[model samples]
Target chain A: MKKLFTGVCVAAALSLSGQAALADVLDDIAERGVLRVGVKADYPPYGYLDEAGNIVGIEPALAQDVADLLGVELELIPVVSSNRMQFLEQGRIDLMIATMTDRNDRREVVQIVDPNYYSSGTNILAPTAAGLTEWEQLDGLPVCGIQGAFYNRKTEEEFGAEIVAFTGTAEALAALQQGTCVAFVYDDSFLISRLSEPEWADYEMPLQTIDDAPWGLAVALGEDRFAELMSGMIVNWHLSGRILALETEYGVDNTPFAERMHQLFLDINPSIER
Target chain B: MDGIEAWFLDLYHTTGINLTIVYDAFDRERFLWGLLNTVILSVICLVFSVIIGIIGAWLLGARHAIPRRIVQAYVQFFRNTPPLVQMYFFFFALGPMFMTTVERHVGQMVFVSETPLLTSFHWAVISLSFFAGAFNVEIFRSGIEAVPRSTIEAAEALGMSRWQIYRDVILPLAFRICLPALNNNLVNLVKTTTLAYAIAVPELLYMSNQIWSDSVNVPEMMTVLLFVYVGLVAILVFAMQRWERAMKLPGFGR
Candidate 1:
């Protein structure tokens, strides 16, 4: 039994090493004429399956643009937030346009492409009647939020609000609707999308953006060439206003944060013309 | 072809398998701390639930019908309801009330790292104890009943008081008979400690999830979680088996 196990381990390790050293991803994609991209199939206005089962959203559209730029067929591989990076690192997808937030910790394992595609920030989603006008007003009030969110600890300490965190955003929203908390604290872009739904019409974003986190595309580690190419493509998109056009087409809120990022991208990339 | 290797390969994508992600993302200190928290939570819950079980079992033997029914209701309600729902009820519904009461008395909200850690951890312990205690009640009761009635009669005939008969005679014998069931309950209690992560208790699973999110290596992190739990449960089972052998009442389990 032990010998057989050792043999299999050797085989697996050999295959993994062989696969890693085999080819450059950009060249592989170019040679194959296919760009497989992992995209969220559940989050709306970012990436979600339409009524016809087509993957349609801002992220998927951006993935299509990437494939178009590469002059290859786009294969949309549906991915959730949890499994998207694994899919990228394991070579299941060439790129990840899955609404992944750029953070220093994630940068160690996955190469997050520079020139963020979009910006999101933590905000308070409160009932319109609550009149929660400022951040300090949350002091001593109960706030519901999803567990494991980056802003959970910050919201707790900075605002002095008692956080009632749940395992998912759905539960957090439900708790807020049921008045378990004075407000639901989550990403501003997600809350903005939620506010458009008739069910969530009564909820209003009361506080301005607290902590802005940019969303970036992720590639496997050691894919420096692929990362630089993708990053440059995003910069070009920002300079040409393609990103803002997609935002309008997808009904994403044209927040001031995004506008400023656009200006910054144009300012930095003077060699690229609109 | 072997079982372990096949299982390991199934954890990754079929085209290529990389275990480096696991090696790279592994945080020895954080994982050790998480393991410690899990062990501490499980031990605390096990101790409290055993206490609740013994008290509950004794009360269940009461002559009065009302108290027996109350104990019966507690055992029934807790054992039947999902532990996850019970966790939410305690964390969401009762947690704020507890904080308010504390604040009312102290004139300020007590916090650690900007949140009420004590209150949340308190609720996590309370929920787990009550949940497991319900099952332990039945286990203990059956253990007590399995004790030969002739032994109790023998202690009574020796002019032993009720408390004496229970403590010196009945309880010791009952524990011997119930050792296997009690060990099973303790193992289950260890497994259920993962549920504490849902309430953000920073136990093993919660910390592992934090690492996985930060690293974006779900497969690697999940493998770590699975092995950590398996190791924990194995240690508990091994310890219990050793203790059972040491305390083996000859011919009792046989």
Candidate 2:
């Protein structure tokens, strides 16, 4: 009786292990009726908690819509800027909709989807009272920034600017507000949004755009089926005019630059009829 | 005369802003605000940790075997686990329970907002204090035990009350002996406060991170950040060393 029981237990354990190995995220999400998405909740106009304390933003909204189309509920997992990819690789999230730039380095680790919706350039935000009209005016002056942002290398190599980097946007803002740096370098859209705020009326982005960088979402490599599904969704959304509708809804349509992005998306995916 | 000099001059002519911008950005008002928040967090953690440490040490140092063993288990458990894990458990797992309890009693009395009285900052302080206190309890307990039993006996024979014995005899000597360990613990506590950034308490590191993400000039920003943190920690170490030296007495043999 003991021998039979031991044999049964070993067989059962082996079967369970085999089943666990075969489990795919796409299948699991489908069965669970929820798409677990990782997003940076601190970033505004992207993924942030609304006034009502609900997670509401562009990426999260898009995630929710995607989940809805898939007939699944949306489960948003708040991720910091640094750890979003780690979360994706570790299976902590099914998809990442954070403002992750599609870089050649990152492409080695994760598969990138087509139809990058957002295009932004780096710019300098300085105090209006600083008399700084150009980037050159920031020479010999400290510039505040975030730690993991890509511009750190370029800023140092190209401009010879003294950079004071913080870990997040809020800290950098506080530093900028406190005059820790003469100027701040960040994405143009973020700079524009923050500068437009009543509290930051004193600050202005005086320099021209530095680089044309496009942003995209990333999924784990080898998940071709899931990637295809995501691409198909984007194509379908573009075709149905839903992408533009979402852009308008999120207030991205208000900017002439973003309107150009909308046209760019249409240009790339001509099959997107609307 | 060198290529580097020309490059530097060209870059300076191109990217450098006016000094007024630096002055405006690093204004005193905002620094004071950040400093105020930092000091408040430190003070709250210090007081709460000391109190918890004393209570925990007393419990562990009790004559009874069972209670002492239980306290030892607690000390070992908290000490063994990472403070970050503890913070997460407190904030995510146990936070709901605490919030519910508070909401039942005081949520109605206070204005209803999204976040309750058990704010993220409060949770950060509470978690850090308890985490630090657990280690402090062991330090204090060892110091208490190191106090010669004869000294306590003499105090007792002289008709001193329990409180008097603890206050006049045990505590002073124990504190003197534990000063070095306690100083180390205090420094650890200050550094550990950086973990509060994880829960979005807007501490120094978090502030820097936010700034970097928004600004994108990470290398320059991080260099400044490294200096700031190193400078802060160095100052703390220097101050503590001075304190330890001042407290030392040649005859006492501490």
Candidate 3:
């Protein structure tokens, strides 16, 4: 019985040590010489499929920048809102830069590194003629949005707006364009990029951002070193003006979070490093 | 390793069967709501499809050739094309035109979702009814044909009118003969309501997706979804068996 107990103890120790070896995600990526990032291929301006069928967007570009900084090749794994976290937890990807919002509830399953890379919030894009400049004014109005969005139920309950949710962004936006709803409620960052286009010129963002959330890169639980590495790279990008430049390159408007992070990064690291 | 090679290896590692996540991720309210929507959608589709089927069968049995041909064309067109494609065509292409005419007459838009004139619910019903109604036409026709020619001749000899013969002799017999096919069609229709989630109907499948996304428990949510569908289909089959027993013909399918 004593010998059997000792054998069990030895086996447990070996398995625990094996798990510890897999915990250092940063070391794993460095050794592999490739940073696999899960990013969105459906969302535009942040991440999307280009006309050439290649993944091209702001998030993909940021991930590429991270890969370059680490001297590793970038491998982008396309993910949607539904499976991004699972991809991280299961080690399918080393990092998640798929426009994942940092919510407290999500912290249970994955680790979201902060000094967030970017920020966006739910907002309404209405016809300029409607003059809906405030959230309260949406009362009794039918508003269109994508289904399964966290904000859909909130807007309905809080603002008295009727929500007409669609499965796709294209359909939801088309619904707003065709006057199926008085306004289209969606992520402000996406609307900022879309409103720049000629077709969407007639519509205007009428309200300030609601449900403000920061987009952060996430890693599997127990990968603190990897999260630290990611957060540090993000801060360096902000200080070096790379994030602002990437925004311009991608033709997306910079969020307040980016501007503030840049200011903070400059104040702390005043010395010139180009 | 190459990017594709790395991705495939990692995918293989991560996608292993894990059922614990389902227990961790289950949300009763979300699941219940999804089940409710699915039930509502299926019930609506079933009722309307049956009505359309009956009407279509009557039209197909019409004395006039053009009317019968038209009914035949509807059955042929719907049955030949895939249900998914028909749904898309109706929702995207024909839905707006129909809504435009409706709005023009009503002097206001009756539904929201700027692109579709009808709500996803209405479109689900409309598209599903037409799809199922097509098959129902054929099913009912086969049942009507299975009614004995000698029985019809006997009714005619008894000085029965065409309407009386159809109401008394043909329809009742056809109904009994068609019960099994009707049951099968209904079961298929109930299962097909899952597709409505693609159009953002917030049915069971859509709600499960939302829950899994929110909870990050794909395995758990998926397990729950599997059981929900199995339970639904089982319930339907059981109910149908009971119904079949109750409506059994005297000497049929012993």
Ranking by DockQ: 3, 1, 2
* lDDT of all predictions: 0.77, 0.68, 0.77
Candidate 3: TM-score?
Answer: 0.65
Q: Identify the runs in model 1 with alpha carbons over 4 angstroms from their true place.
A: A1-165, A173-185, A193-254, A258-274, B1-27, B101-118, B251-253
Q: Against the true structure, candidate 2 has what lDDT?
A: 0.68
lDDT score for candidate 1 against the true structure? 0.77
Per-residue lDDT of model 2, residues B1-254, tens digit only: 35554554465457752211123243223334444666678768877887887778777756789988877887788888998888767755565454321111111232111223364577889888888898889888878888999989999999998778777888777777887798788778877887876555656665555445544545755676566667766777898788778867676642
Please report, as a residue range, the 10-residue window in candidate 3 chain A with the lowest summed lDDT: A1-10
lDDT pick, better of 2 and 3: 3
For model 1, which pairs clash?
none
Give residue A13's lDDT in candidate 3 (0 to 100). Answer: 53
* Regions more than 4 Å wrong, model 3: A1-117, A135-143, A147-164, A183-185, A210-254, A262-274, B1-30, B99-117, B252-254
Q: Residue A45, candidate 3: how far off, in angstroms? A: 6.0
**Predicted candidate 1 versus true structure: per-residue lDDT over B146-236, tens digit per residue:** 9888999999999999889878988888888888899999899999999988776768887676556554667877887888789989998
Top candidate by TM-score: 3
Ranking by TM-score: 3, 1, 2
Off by over 4 Å in 2: A1-274, B1-35, B65-70, B100-114
Error of 2 at A226 (Å): 25
